[model samples]
Target: MNWETLIDEESLALLLPAEYSHFALPIKESLAVFLSRLPQSVQDRLVEEQLALPVDATLSERLGRLAHSCPVLQKLGQILARDQRIAQELRSELAKLESMPSTVPLHSIESILMQELGPLESKSIELLPPAIAEASVAVIIPFREKNKPQQPEGVFKILKPGIVQRLQLELDILTEVGSHLDSRLHDLGIPPLDYQDTFNQVRDKLRCELRLDEEQLHLARAARFFADQIDIAIPELFEHCTPRVTAMERLFGEKVTDHNFTLTTEKQNLAELVARAMIVQPILCKDEQALFHCDPHAGNLFSTNDGRLGILDWSLAGFLGAREREALVQVMLAAICLRPEKIATTLLSLDIRGQCDQALLKECVAIWLRRMREGHMPGLSWLTGLLDEAVKTARLSLSSDLLMFRKSLLTLLGVLSEIGANGFDLDQIVMCEFLRITVMEWPGRWLSSPNSRSFATRLSNLDIAETVLSSPLIAGRYWQAMWQDSIERYAVCANSR
Candidate 1:
């Protein structure tokens, strides 16, 4: 490998998109940085831009980064957001607001406070998960390697539960005294569409809407690597529970949008496996709850040389408590089995709608049901479009809390069909899994883990998650702590980069 060549277009067409052609820079640069410590040939190919434009980094590498950052960030924010002395000091000043006339611009204090706050990021790379004793994963060690980990590029973190009551108190005042904040719009006056742009495009739109430049979007996305740090920057309100942060672990793998080998099926199989692992792991956890790693963008999805699927970024993960998971199981079963009304009924059980919109929800469910039954298998684009539109048009203000479940279902099925890799259909598989789970639950359904072993019995005697409907605090403090860490992870990873 030398400076003369990059991954040729023919091989690249299998993975890279034209729109993402521009993203080649960061990906390439990151790879170069990672490869620089490796053998001269690897260095020549990556650093000298001699390897093909898109080569692959494996999955474990990505996850290792994700897992490491998530915890580190949480640790950082726990120290900062929950610093009672700082809060006590800051809160002491709010009384002064009593002296100002009602018209005084107080929120300007936001800028002043932001200036005073400072945080840090993690150093070096988190290369892989601890070795599992049950299953062995083959590692494709590069010919030359660095003794220390290379940091992820372009990430940042935010404060957790800082000014908890005060911020909300201010937001309430701002909401009541609100002179309409600008509706989200680009200079083109074109509002952003949730479904239209893929991940990267969405970030660009975000930069514009938020008045940031290309560098900022890079910073934000790169922050995905330091997910562990999110909680450190932001603190949760309840001292009993920790806050959450979502972060990304950028993919370090060869992109394969097309199949060139006879074993092409491996790609889809691995992808579906990745998707399944994501769903299964949550249930495996004691709480049956974990952040749904939402972004599965190209840079986010990787097939390292060895072929394990890694999911990155738990930043926007959707968390499901015991009841929520149960409700979700019910809904997923209903959707796959083509029972639209049943799904709607389950949503109603979750109190997804107000009394007035019950009929509309049912009607919408009917529409979705009909599409599932009569139409071709659900397509990702169409489904994403509908999901986005429903939220946008939602007058009743349904929280997008369950969105990741919807996405997990869609993305699992989608990547399979797109690559023609496997017969993986989320609705189909989830339905099957539920039928088994439901049977298993018939007797053990109410059973809880040891930490919360008695919870099911208590819940059986009482309504829990549903009753706490509007709470942003789902899955309690343990999860909140995990979430907070996610943000810190991104922040640290970004700074390290």
Candidate 2:
């Protein structure tokens, strides 16, 4: 694909709003400079392909088509599809990329399997005709083991042929564009953002998705973490696996967004299950590091027949260290208690450079609190909004892990809204999960002094201690706020009457 030609002046102009037209020429020039640096053969190939490309009428269509051709852009589209902030038309167009049609032929997939896992016949594996599913970077082929009839059918997730080269090329383009943008932010009339740093972070994450070995490791670790949960199902890894291909137990169910439920109760239950699996459990996990599914799009999540939430695609994940986890918990606690000052303090502490304006940070926290009190659900949106405001208002720097987690949560919230779970009180859910963990661990925490415990155990105990000491005060404040709200409601009712 000729990205430079495809992302020509017209396409770039279409991407930017009319008000931002001034920014387009610089971007185009930057892209041109980057493309010129490509090898002669690569440049020639791109030039050859330029004439063969089809044209789309609208911007959305063009973008969707481009995403289909470029895996990196397809990933960006998938993320944007779940974002409500984007234009509905664009979101709808990008959403189609989630269930991209299988462009890779069956023979190509079969060849990858043979190359990676040797002959299917030797392994007693029979590859099913046609692929069962296809995504941005890989195609999933269902296969059955002739020798293991008792075992469930498995699917081989094979990377698309030449994806590595294509993806790396696109990533390099993005990096070049980001660097240019970073240097020209002032001329573009946009606020200064670490565009280079941001793209580097994104590049690292996308690169991780290329490695199936890391995904397998994540899957194994997640399986251990959720070992006791009956409601969650992690696919079991099969022996025949490679970096380009992974064999795992095939799960059967509809996408959570697509599932049809006869009852709202069922939908609500499924929503809570999604919440627990994606948000609550990961946040309150006892492990030293909490592993979160970075991509929780509808395509990656399934509503299994056995009433279990099947979380698939472990390729991209985020890990929160103990300190980060505790900080998150503290922020949640403060939010639930409606303590804006505490929230500000917690956020400022995270700014290792200590450059944030405390007053401005407090104001931002207060605004978030006001929204929550006005019935905005304190879920990912609320938390992310607070962080974003902090960044804009106080110039606070947040960790990349939290930013990645925010993206995951944003995607999860989009899924929840699709399944009618947006109404679920996430603030209440967080409080409940925290209390459950505190109560469950109280005995051990009470028996052992903080001094006797290991560093990780001490941190765990400290979390419990804070929760134990704050619950009553938080409860009292919560009731007081509820009472005040109820009284106001009564007054409004009386006045209407």
* Clashing pairs for predicted structure model 2, backbone only: none
Candidate 2 CA-lDDT value: 0.76
Q: Compute each candidate's TM-score over C-alphas.
A: 0.38, 0.80
Q: Candidate 2, residues 1-497: lDDT per residue as tens digits?
A: 33455555665565555655666677566556556655577667555554455544565666566556557768877877866555567778888877766778888888888888888899899988778778878888888999999989999888889878867776777777778877877776654556676777788888877899888998898899789999999999988888998999999997898888878888889988898889887777767788898888888889999889999999998887777766655676678767777888888877855667888788788677767878886764577688888876786876777778888887887788778754676667766876676576667766766633323222456555666787779767767777877797899999999
Q: Cα deviation of 15 in candidate 1 (Å)?
A: 20
Off by over 4 Å in 2: 1-56, 332-345, 352-381, 448-497
lDDT of 1: 0.35
Worst 10 residues of 1 by lDDT: 133-142
Candidate 1's residue-wise lDDT over 346-463, tens digit each? 6666544453256666666656645554454543333444344434333222234455455554444434444455555554544455346435444654555423322322232123
lDDT of each: 0.35, 0.76
Report model 2's TM-score to 2 decimal places. 0.80
Cα misplacement distance, residue 71 of candidate 1 (Å): 25
